[model samples]
Target chain A: MVAHETLSRRSVGSDLRAMGAVAGKELTIARRYPSFLIAVLVWPVLLPLAYILGAKALAGPHGGSLPAFEAATGTTDYVGFIVIGTLLWGWLNMTLWDVGFFIRNEQMRGTLESNWLCPVPRGALLIGATLTKLALSLLFLVISIVEFRLLLGVNLLQGNLALTLLIIALIIPSIYGLGIAFASLVIRFKEANAMVFLVRGVFMIFAGMTFPIAVLPGWMQAVAMALPLTYAIAAMRAVVLNGAGLADIRGDLLALVAFGVALPIVGYLAFGHMARRARRHGDLGQY
Target chain B: MTATLSAPSWRSNLRAMTAIARKDFIQYLRYPMNAVFNVLQPLIWLTPVYFLGKTFASPVGNVGFAGYSGTTDYMSFILIGTVLANFITTVFWGMGYSLKTEMDAGVLESNWAAPVPRPVFLVGRTLASITITAAMSVVMLILGAWLFGFHVSGNVLAALGVAVPMLIALYGFGFAFAALVLLMRDANTMIDVSNFLVTLLSGSQFPVTVLPTLVLLVSLALPLTYGFDAVRGLLLGTNTLLPIPVEVLLLIVFMVVMVWVGLVVFRRVERRCRVLGTLNMH
Candidate 1:
């Protein structure tokens, strides 16, 4: 009875420690791979370069079609528009790969079963892994902002920096909430790559990453509205490009708040269900 | 008075290649969802591009795009590029990542121990990927046309004829790439980055004229750029980077040189891996 009381009281502190350890382990593994670091640096510049060039091609030599693009999107600054959209999407893609597959990777490496045997909460471990990915994503975003300025001449911080930060903070829960829920689903489905492709593909097609959502069909617009990324990208473009104030983006912010609150609760519930299911089925070790 | 189970003969090599191809094909089919996604993923990527092109279109056509590529049918221009890019991906991943997969499975050494020529084994691994890519490309193109209104006005047969040498050159490059994968033992990042970069620089998504001056020079230096240019020229009547005859000749020359160089580099690296006993280390 005394031991149980002590264990219950110390649980929160112990879970925090477990999360930190997992984060440290992931960061260490990331540092050991030079290719991973290279990819982090290269992809920010490389991925958007294609779209920027495509936009340039469409704009013609003397900027003949800039008016059409400007009409579709608010600004003729296609570089800045494309950069912001692709950067956020890249973060989502990275999270899907890292957090979504964290458990499956451990399973494949034969450490997951042993790790599950620990006294720590499994949710703590998943969040711990997510913490490292979250850190890497922050680094990716910083790199992208600098690279876009230096290489592409697109200054992401030209507008309201405080509002931009607020948008990022608001979207954090939604992105990772979706990732955590995706992690649970991936554990159940076992087709990690396909699941990642499906989820990210949905966002890529529906989130208006390279083009404005106004260009999408009416049905596609309705589908786009259902995704949190659509709001995130739209809000980001407003603050960063058009220098929209808080009053201008209240609807987006409110929608993000709703997603932020709802998604994590859903994620935790899904994760609980999956964890219980895995333990009951005796399939924690299966990949 | 003994029967040979394995022999180093031309006929035996052909059988070994066929077996390898068949095995890969079977393994691919085992993942039914993956097989389906393989065809759908490219289409998903194209949807955004299709929308992006629409954003730039006028009532007539993409008048701005026509200024660069001399084609108002932007979807057709992009579709042809996408098909060629798919083949490039097949070659890069087929040879490099196939060897990496074998290494991870702990089968590289045992597979190399067989009597078949090493080049045959490497080339054989790609046969399944090439076939799948070709079949998927056809489906992807048909879907692209239906969904995005893709159409080509120029000669399809002649365009394919131009692509033949380019595919051969890519296979040649794949041989050397497989040797590198064998040496490195971890090739996922390298293969992905190189494949994306090569395709990007080779005008797989847009004309090279849109690239920055230095980047355009790098694009010009790649033979695959000429391949994409010539095919687009033949099929879409896009303004060729060079005259059609000159681009075809360049492709033929590149094919011969890359094959010879690829074989030479592959032999030397295979010997080095054998000497160092690193064939089994991934």
Candidate 2:
């Protein structure tokens, strides 16, 4: 009876250790590729550049269309508005590709099956990768702020810094939650790039990355409201660009909090179902 | 035993290229969803740009944009750019990303060991994708016209004439990039960033005149900028940076220079990789 109990029961402490080990392993592998550092520096400036230039041309040589843009977005600083939106969207995009494809990459490397054979909870492996992604995302954010300020002459730090941090913290759960759910779907569908294009393309069109949601058609606006990034971008723009306090962004905050709570639960349920199905069917190695 | 091999000729080269293109086309058709997405993906990217133009409308049909590019038909300008940009993407992917894909599949070295000339192999890889891109560009343009009201008022054959040199020049650029992929072993970030930068700097989404002074200089230096500008000028009657004839002259000159430089660089780098025995390492 004692031996059976010991075999069946594993402590939370062991899972935590496994998570840390996986995170460290991922971090080490990431460091092996130094060129990624170039991406970290280059993307923040380059990603928003074309849109900013497009806006410049649209504003005309003498800034004639500034009135229309200012009226649509409520700020003449299209650069700030675009930068904030793309930054958050870029974070979500990276998380989707990095954490969502983690399992598939492991499978391709032939490490996933062996890792699944271990006694640790399979969720811990994913969570461990998520932790590394979070760390890298944080690094990306810091670099983005410096690069944007220097290159584009936009100040992302001019906002209420504390509120900006809080907004980032709140958006984390939704981002990773969607990523977890996405990872499971990729496992089931076995088409990683197609799935990524479909999912990210939805956000790109609906989330007002380069334009205000108010500019979208009525149905598209409805879809934008349903996405967490719409609120996150709106809230970040409000605080960072408009200098709005907590009160000005209360609605966006509440919406983000709701998504933050709901998405993770949905993600966990989806991941749990996928893990069981893969193990039962012995399909964990198939992809 | 003596084995006599057929002397290499244009006919044999053509046969080799046809075989390579056929294999790639077969593999591409095996994934129907990917083929479908190739048509949809550009439209997906264009949606925001479409809405972005809508946001800037002043009830006078993009009068502000007209001040920059000489026309308020912003979607038309963008759609033309998109059509030209599609060929650029095909060349980049066909030469660079395909090499990376072959490397990951552990077949690149074996494929290279064939008796065919290496440059022929690279060009053959692009043939299927180029055909597909052209077909999809037509469908995308039709969808753009229906959805965003994009229409071309210029001579289609003339626009194609300007585009031919630009596409050939891109082949030269792709060869150099493929050599880089051979060296780097990782292609995603490099390809993504470079592709985005090239298209953006070439004024795919907006007029290059609006760029800051330094960036505009960079834009003018890229041969693709003239390619985009001349095509848009012809199709939409938008402003061109130079006289149309001069731009065409520049593109022809660029095509000659880039192809020569590209072939030289690729041969040198590929030889270096073979010496280092790193062709199959990735």
Give Cα-based local distance difference scores for all models: 0.90, 0.90
Give the runs in model 2 whose Cα sits over 4 Å from its true position: A1-8, B1-5
List candidate 1 segments past 4 Å from native.
Answer: A1-9, B1-7
When summed lDDT is taken over every stretch of 10 residues in candidate 2 chain B, the lowest stretch is B1-10
What's each prediction's TM-score? 0.96, 0.96
Mind giving the per-residue lDDT tens digits that candidate 1 earns over B97-195? 988988899988888888778889888998998999999988988888899888888898999999999999998889889988978888998999999
The DockQ-derived docking category for candidate 1 is high
Report the poorest 10 consecutive residues by lDDT, candidate 1 chain B: B1-10
Candidate 2 per-residue lDDT, tens place, A117-151, comes to 88888889899999999999999999999999888
